[model samples]
Target: MTEEPPIAVLTDDTAYAEAVQLAVDSAAAYYADGTSTLDDDAYDRLARGIQAYEEAHPEAVLATSPTGKVAGGAVVGDVPHTVPMLSLDNVFGAEQLADWATSLERRLGRPVAAWSVEPKLDGLAISARYRHGRLTQLVTRGDGTAGEDVSHAIGTIVGLPARLAEPVTIELRGEVLMTTEQFEVACLKRQAHDGTTFANPRSAAAGTLRAQDRPYVCELTFFGYGALPYPDDASEQAASLRELPHSEIMTWVAAQGVQTTAATPVAGIVAETLVQVQERIEQIATVRPELPFNIDGIVIKCDLAADQSQAGFGSRAPRWAIAYKLPATEKITKLIGVEWNTGRTGIIAPRAVLEPVELDGSIVTYATLHNASDIARRGLMLGDSVTVYKAGDVIPRVEAPVVHLRTGDERPIEIPQVCPSCGDGIDSSQERWRCVRGRSCRAIASITYATGRDQLDIEGLATSRIEQMLDAGLISDFADLFYLTREQVLGLERMGETSTNNLLAAIERTKAQPLSRVFCALGVRGTGRSMSRRIARHFGSMDAIRAADAEAIQAVEGIGPEKAPVVVAELVELAPLIDKLVAAGVTMTEPGWRPPAVPGIDVDPDAQTAPEAGGTSELPLAGMSVVVTGSMSGALEALTRNQMNELIERAGGKSSSSVSKKTSLLVAGENAGSKRAKAESLDVRIVGPEEFADLVGALL
Candidate 1:
């Protein structure tokens, strides 16, 4: 066995200074390129090493060193900054933090007596400019000189205020981030769209904010760190600003309804020595794991404004402040192999099979590769050591492979040419490879969809049971599910006699499901429960629907010419399956179902859709599309929005979820928001909840 040579430690003062400068330049370049060469842990260690070198030989510290300036530079920023949003210098642990405190005292030539400590949030830095209490402009931190203008995108951020609590012109700097739950949802959506999933919450937040297309929906939030044009405290007269604390200023910011670390309950510690500050940092570290969002470290600032000013400013960061970064929740493990799984939508997603490593208190064995593009982007290869990190503490993601550690035996990842589950050809039209068989090949998903509440309404059929049935070959298609005898169901792994009886009863009950439901269960392209209802009403039966041509199908509202052919093709392909469903004694026609004048209503034309006895024979709401929003008040508080829609449908009307040009009527209630405004803009007729209830009462 050969031993690796020791890494040369820099002892020469000049050489140490040059090494620090090189590290800073590399970090800045990496930031500008939207990629990072160093992990958080490695960066912190580098930063600490630089600090140590400077402390050991104070005369050798360079004013223009990377350690003196902010780490990231924004060359692409368009909006000129009014006040530079400087980055903080980082320290790793308690010892480094103490050294930083001692350095600060030595620089100021005074004993540091107070500090304001807060979480160093792992997110994108943003400056929000407000004018007279109204949010005006928002920008990203671009090299502390100029920032990218993202005013158009600010409204999409969930926790950011559109209008201030008090109308005052001010510039507030904060970190923009998505909560772990939000990141998970965003990843799901991105993967569904064949887009790359973000590596972490911070990355996701940054990418979402910088997206050129404005008004995109995302659950991004902001937490104010500081504000420009500091608030005036006329009541107190201080000695050279020394008496004024930064904690108090932040308190004022929070009082104005701006979210800050105060909401996070970031403790303000007044420490005369470095030991006390270390204790405070340790306290924060112990509780950081339970926080809602990602926070990489703790930030300690000179509490007294006078002391902060006395310490002065660096080329890129404040001299009085330092960030104490926590140990990174990352690990390097061997990329043992890769496993492919098919999503319900037929997307073939890759999962990395890893040699188990403990990270952030959990043993992680697998991580999502997202897609082939992501795998390629990371240059992942089998039998190579890979870096893995958890995004939002929930999803494990493969960051990259350690190419330097790779042996010659490592193999390049090859995307599967066929679906791993069903052995069907892969559809490569999109970045995400999908199964050519689509929904049919996904037996569990097809059965689950068929038995959903809005479809065939088959009770006692859970997803696990569906998978079991498919595994046992008791069900090859949705129709085969109906033909499962009690004996066959009893043969399932977990099935008991009572469970089998319930399963048989549930399947038998589905035979009476209306033809519209059968159509929905068929899983035709460009068709759902509502579309199925429209088709059933238009053709009166399944046979008529099958016989209808594309032009005839196009007549249904929402089913246009392009979608009409898709519907026909899907139905034709399902002919044999449909025949089997008919043979299983499932309902082929809706006995008393009549076409509502408008689409999407499960209403009888005779106005008998609602439980109420009588209906207006005139059907005054016929052919009208109605939308309901907000909470109902007064007499109609007992009725839900769905009930109201049903009442409208029974009156020969259609109920829509969104207010569009097609919406002829809008039943608005208390606290109606954007929907009411949209309805008014579209010239939609507006009625109060009481009036709507009265109208329904009159019809009934």
Candidate 2:
């Protein structure tokens, strides 16, 4: 009989005095009932580690695995987007990007005389659909085809209004991102407590919106990324009902309490308009974070109705629109030495050792030195200062520092530098400087990345942790986390039931993360998050991803020989690790992973009983967006916290999270935070919950 593929690998260990089951159960509890169980930092680190394991062993990966999907509560039903949301095909360098514009022009049978460049936000896309001047549905952009109902989630948003002034139905689409200010505060918190912090704003925003709590949702903001335009004759279905210009329509949309895309119209894609889009991207770093949402790149689209229709969609994206994403953030420092490092695929490259410095918030000790020419471009020598920051469209690079900073201690790192392992000679013909014995290089890129901010970000699992685990026969590969025993964990200094359980619990929570994070944690050379997504879309299943060969992987945009071999090699080496993880009981399935169904409004419980409740309670807030402030008694808390939700629904009104111009009224309690201050500045209407209840009683 043919042997079935190996499934179980990890055996219960004698090393642990107490069963790990409790910790595992706690992790399950945390993910299942969020708000309890694991803290946010623990959860994040665990999630990232599980992702790494899945990436390595695509075949053994679980369907319920967290790879390639966003997490959320069980959505009651799905709703179709009014306008089908189409995602963009990204390009890193400017040349490939210019090629996109040229192709668009060629496809349209014209020389694209001019183009607009706009920031492409790094966030989730959403749609807010309204009908007859009343607030309606809010949905997540699930899979570009359909979305999940998130109206309850919408109630907590800072900017969106509960009701509109005009009696017209419309759908608006936009992006959600965190601003620089939010990032700083969040980073500070993480650093302060030795917690896992967010790598960037876009991912953080996406994570925030997925929470079940409306209060959490209030922390996220949405901005128009794209819109559905009506026909010039106003004959399209939505347009005929509302007679307004597209630009004016956007303004009306804002009036209804949604942030629309930023724009300054000119006489048809003129110099002034083009400059505005460019200027916006350049100034994004200076924008106020408190304004709500985030933007990373700019998107330029044909403004005129006729012009947009003429420029249509191709296979993947629209011909009418183009995005100008910022290149990776970069910085420079002097190169101390050229060090050879083996990455996931074991290819060796020179990494520049440098004096520690800060980037964004994290300290940087090294930069990918790349090749001999890159080293020469900056002119390197012993004691010569160098620059370090992201490279083209990337964060920080090391061009040698200002010549003035060079000191005797500085030395030129020889391209074809000595092999890091044996101090033997190296080999190179300009393209890549490599150690002849590549695998022996002392530097380890993948291991370093396993602990890096964007990948695993596992707390207490620093370079030191890795070395300890390595020496203790605890791990040699990324998947080993699944096999850790509680007893073995507690044996480590400072590790106890609480910390041990916390770490393992983190592991359980992350078992079902999306595929993008998986790809990222793999640290495949030159294949970062965006490219990983494309690979995921094509492969779909982990088994298929693992089975695919280099040529197939290389077919994706920007996947060249340099990156392809690295991925293929890494995949091959990950087989044993995958087997061990599965044996050890790491979940390999994509639990609760459902793509968006056809768009249709689900029966919101509040909406279903809304009419009757509206008449019975909250007479004062009948059909009004209300915000609450300060500490209060239990009754007031109920009224402001959840009761307001029911009352607003019953009265045919909706409750909003923050106070803004669109806010109908504020229910003040005591000890109000920024919301109170912001409300005063905006001059929004405010009232006490007691007064609100009285108003409701009188109205009812």
Name the best candidate (by TM-score).
1
Stretches of model 1 off by over 4 angstroms after superposition: 1-34, 45-67, 74-78, 107-110, 214-216, 230-243, 265-276, 331-336, 339-387, 390-700
Q: Tens digits of per-residue lDDT for model 1 on 233-277?
A: 232322322255777767767776778876553444466556666
Each candidate's number of clashing pairs is 4, 83
- The list of candidate 2 runs beyond 4 A from truth reads 1-77, 111-117, 180-199, 213-218, 229-237, 240-249, 261-294, 330-700
In model 2, where is the ten-residue run with the lowest total lDDT?
Answer: 1-10
Compared with the true structure, what per-residue lDDT tens digits does model 2 show for residues 1-700?
A: 0111112222223211112232344344332322223332233334444454555555555444432433222222267655556655444334545566567667767644344444455566677776665657777765455677767666655456666665555666766556556655554454454333333444445555565642222255566533453223254645642433345445656666566544311111222243444443334322312234444345656554555566777544667776554432423344556676544444556676777765433577877666666555445564545445442224455543444334557554654456555576666643665555543243244555654555544555667666676677776666677667888878886677887888777766555544444556666556765455556545544566788888888876668877887688767756665566557654343221222234785644442213332332334455477776676553456442544543443343556665556778777778775566556545678777677667656322
Positional deviation of 535 in candidate 2, in angstroms? 58
Q: What local lDDT score does residue 158 receive in model 1, on the 0 to 100 scale? A: 66
Candidate whose lDDT is highest: 1
Each prediction's TM-score versus the true structure: 0.48, 0.35
- Candidate 1 collision pairs: 74-143, 133-167, 133-168, 614-700
Worst 10 residues of 1 by lDDT: 1-10
